[model samples]
Target chain A: MRALVLLRAFSRAKAHTLLFSSHCARRHCHAPAKRERAKGPRILGPDLPDIWRSPPLDSTHPPPPLIDANQEINPTIIDGNSIAEEIRSRTAEEVHQMKDAVKKIPGLAVILVGQRRDSQTYVRYKIKACHEVGIRSLTAELPEDCTEDEVVDSVSRFNEDPSVHGILVQLPLPQHMNEERILGAISLEKDVDGFHPLNVGNLAMRGREPLFIPCAARACIELLTRTGIELMGKHVAVIGRSKVVGLPTTLLLQRHHATVSSVHAFTKNPQDITRQADIVISAAGVANLVRGSWLKRGAVVIDVGTNPVEDPSSEHGYHLTGDVCFKEAVKVASAITPVPGGVGPVTIAMLLSNTLDSAKQIYGLNC
Target chain B: MRALVLLRAFSRAKAHTLLFSSHCARRHCHAPAKRERAKGPRILGPDLPDIWRSPPLDSTHPPPPLIDANQEINPTIIDGNSIAEEIRSRTAEEVHQMKDAVKKIPGLAVILVGQRRDSQTYVRYKIKACHEVGIRSLTAELPEDCTEDEVVDSVSRFNEDPSVHGILVQLPLPQHMNEERILGAISLEKDVDGFHPLNVGNLAMRGREPLFIPCAARACIELLTRTGIELMGKHVAVIGRSKVVGLPTTLLLQRHHATVSSVHAFTKNPQDITRQADIVISAAGVANLVRGSWLKRGAVVIDVGTNPVEDPSSEHGYHLTGDVCFKEAVKVASAITPVPGGVGPVTIAMLLSNTLDSAKQIYGLNC
Candidate 1:
């Protein structure tokens, strides 16, 4: 068990605030610009080759030029995709280090039902991202005819499995199936999705803290925090108050000292109120719903909507667009998250981050 | 059961909104004021109660001169004893009716530990108020040696008993107990205190309604609202963020369209931020804490603190004071709640209100 002492170093990355210090087995790291790491072979995402096979640099097939931390995160320049890739690479390094030390790999199970093409594609993207973060990926593609009992059984299996730290049952699970019941059934401990009532309650309250990692909401705040944006005393407008995204997102934003207004469909003259917001986050899933003038000038925009609209030019006959009218919004808003490239990648990164949290909690690192 | 119901109705001089609307064996359709209730019982608070509780005035206690509908709600002077009496009278008719129908009567359990003279006095006053409201009061005077588990187990037993709807385990439960654990252990369905996470979450989230009810925080807002002071679009400064009162209170104000800034001990320059607010509620439990100069002129203040100050002038050797410097604030501030008299009585009224909620939930009125 003394070998476990070596495993503790990778966990210390969270505490490395001022110094980029880490005790890696190998002189390698996996972020955008890999930094000094603990002693171990470098790990890659599921899509990438093992550390032994892949060379340090792919001079022939070069990856996209990484964005400098100093530069503003650009949406049009595959920002979401890139941020996600960077996160996965970092996770890969940690996973690889653990594997090198003879530890069972951390895993995430994604249970998808029915063929909403967008949802299916999302699962695929998540699977690819999971490997990048060094967390083993398990995908159970259930058919549209699947029973509630079957889904329940699978979640139970994942719950019992020591290897799996997170189990995500993709949203919009067929209308006939009870969504709340299914969501509530997920054990609070393993609910990395952070949609459980206890987690939401903890997030809403002052002293109580959620044990489950709030992936999407946390990602939005983390992106802003990492970007050095000061949130204290900022008035943030969160449009669309869904249980999954908008509501919890508002709570998290409020936690960081941002005065938040959650506007739902019923809110009269929502745009008039939105214009007052210093920060606009539209997770309504309505394509181009947030108009140009609806935004407050210089406001930071985070578009969580992944609504696919019909586009003749696209191969799939549809193009994914966010709730915000990006073209016009970008002109006025100081910064905004892109449709495909913004919040999407950050969600996966946070998921992996949560899995590691579960690993840490299981191992009793700090507690 | 039918005989008991009739007895309960007979006990009260007249029935109020909730009981009259829900449990009344027969409708008072002939009455003019009652005729307007074609939509059945108005579940909304205060407005319905004002219309329903019309007593035939005697020479001694004549209906205080006919005032307009929009006048302030302090029927009695700002003194705590007078306000507590006035509130009791408002619910007098309903109290009579409740006693008529159910011989067992509405009950509230007040659990107290040790002789924290202040807490003991508070509990004693609450028990006295219950009797005034025609409610059966139950007190569990536990020894200072009572373990956390013992307290929790007692609360659990009371929660299972159908008779006890509102259970208040007095705050500052002896040092040995974990407060959050004990509070969390109280069933949300029976939690009239509204300290349960579910209620807090519901209160914080936009559009979602809480089942148990919010009391102390709601009472603070109700005081301001009753005084014809609208919180909508007003900047409210909450100078605390405790789970019980401050945090939930701020969120409730925010939900009502008040731009709220919650400050605490961690907050630097709290008065600077509070000065910008139109309404100030200091629940930090610090006596004479909020100086007059810190307040914005014409700011409506609701002092939710029940801090005890050493005052040898009184027989008890201590006097209950508020978070505000009342003498200083009264000159600058347009309206302020006096420490001992203001929020204390309203808290009991809200407890009664929550019992009605518990009964309503059990009755499935909302569902």
Candidate 2:
């Protein structure tokens, strides 16, 4: 069924392109001014072809104008890499000023267990990010066979260390290890990942603010607001209900006064319901689960899905894909975030920001 | 605007009844079965007249058959009084059994300030309830001019008291006092109202269960589930997003796998959004805010609003009204809960149950 959906999405893209080209030929043939113009047609709705498609331009059909073309025909590409860099740079500046005043830098400790290559890569990136922003990095690597007690012991060491302002446990610990026990061992004040129950509770309640928000969920909303999408009174359909992402995102959205709907795996006619949203955020981790047909014509889409689909052409033999069918959706949606470059980069930036905030709080430095 | 909405609701109800009576005279003039029948027409759509009208039972047509009358007309009234009584009885039975096994009954502590008449009445009712259920009640009455420290000190005394299993501070603390500080002073173990941050956090996250949920929120879900309204895969619209009721209710409903929409004060065209819901739970605190026209035909409504509107005819000079315009809603909804008897009774029953559970946990008795 997954393969069928993928094939169908690709086929829809092809079908739309063919229909667009034929219609363009007939329309341009009748209007000489349109052929002469440098800019593309005003493609504001579902009639527009996917932005990823490169249509040939020659003297007869004269290439659609390059200037102002994107503004007219293309979906807004939310640039997470630049946004992440901006945040990181601001954090680094803050760190520089704090260290100069206090003679101490913020510190973050990470606990990792088992030797998953992906986990190691993520840890390396986090540590590197910390260093880039002038924060101290403390690492404790435990063996896969280590008991839950050993994991908790490592976390407790960091909890007692006054230098460590934040503690993060790389998730998906060894199968036998109890995750709750290990995560709970971290002190709530230094839980920069915002997975602690108290932080989550604060996030869920009104008039109570959580010290930190789960970075990924915060990044999603940050991207939207940074790009100037209005959230108030708008209907947002959240396509997942996971504690870390979906549920918290729903809470945050509702807090922002958006009429929010939470649609999960058990929801009936999920497509029909999701299509009513002015903004659709899919965090279900299901690759290409949301198709072009599942969205409203001008909906804003934030895809938090980072599932790996087998891709033989890639050097790694796999490629990251989002919950949305990008090729098909770009034509339908008004704005969209690409999979790997979108929420992932912003998420790391948010984590760094959180760590810095925690340190500032400890040092009594207002930011 | 509030008065306009209320007036419109009453006018709509009157119009529907007049239209129905006139239509009945014309349609049932020839049908003898119609005049003999106790049941009204099967009104199942937006255009149907309100079902509450009782036209004269003259011999225009003979009385219709009496069998299966309910199958055709009259919505199911969710008798909160009966349901609450049942829950209280069961709680009493559990309390009796626990005392039999461990010679100790559960205890509850309530702290009140400023002596609001309603608050005093509620507190008295709670103490009376505790006595009837074989539980002990402790009350601390503070003056309206009491300092914040005095309130905190009172909470501290109860927190240290081993006999007190649960602590509840009456809400709407004097404007000068900080509610969060006062509420936070309660020990997590004895925070039977479940207002503690950790408990709320557990409630928000999956795989983690809070020791208790705020009673009113739980009562709303209990009423629904006990009445056999399936929450899973259903659309539940929660009006209002207050921390005590609306927000927690939304969280609980989403956790139960329902597609939940949170409509708050900032929501635009709330009636339009509410009409799409299969179940509507209103806690907005505005009397007669939700009109029959705002609901979908056959929708189930759980009203948690308790507001007093001036009524010259009433002995108290005012009468309690729910957020829903109940008189108009009864004709439109499939099932509805009355204001005074609905969530109010269930809420108190839930409090008693929570106190008992706290005692059970403390005694290491598995229930």
Give me the candidate number with maximum TM-score. Answer: 2
Write model 1 residue lDDT over B127-163, tens digit each, in one string.
Answer: 8877777777788888899887888888877777777
lDDT over C-alpha atoms for residue A67 of model 2: 24
lDDT of 2 by residue, B93-163 (tens): 98899889988889999999997988998899899989888889999999999998999999989877878
Model 2 lDDT tens row, A179-278: 6556767776678888877777767765555667788888888788888887877888998877668887887777566789888776666675566678
- Candidate 1 global lDDT: 0.62
lDDT (Cα) of model 2? 0.73
- Candidate 1 vs. truth: CA RMSD? 16.1
Give fnat for candidate 1. 0.12
User: In model 1 chain B, where is the ten-residue run with the lowest total lDDT?
Assistant: B29-38
DockQ of every predicted complex: 0.08, 0.19
How would the docking of model 2 be graded?
incorrect
Evaluated on chain B only, what is the TM-score of candidate 1?
0.76
Can you write out model 1's per-residue Cα lDDT over A12-120, one digit (the tens) per residue?
3223311322222111111111111212211110111001111112122211122333555334322666666666677777677666655767788899999998788
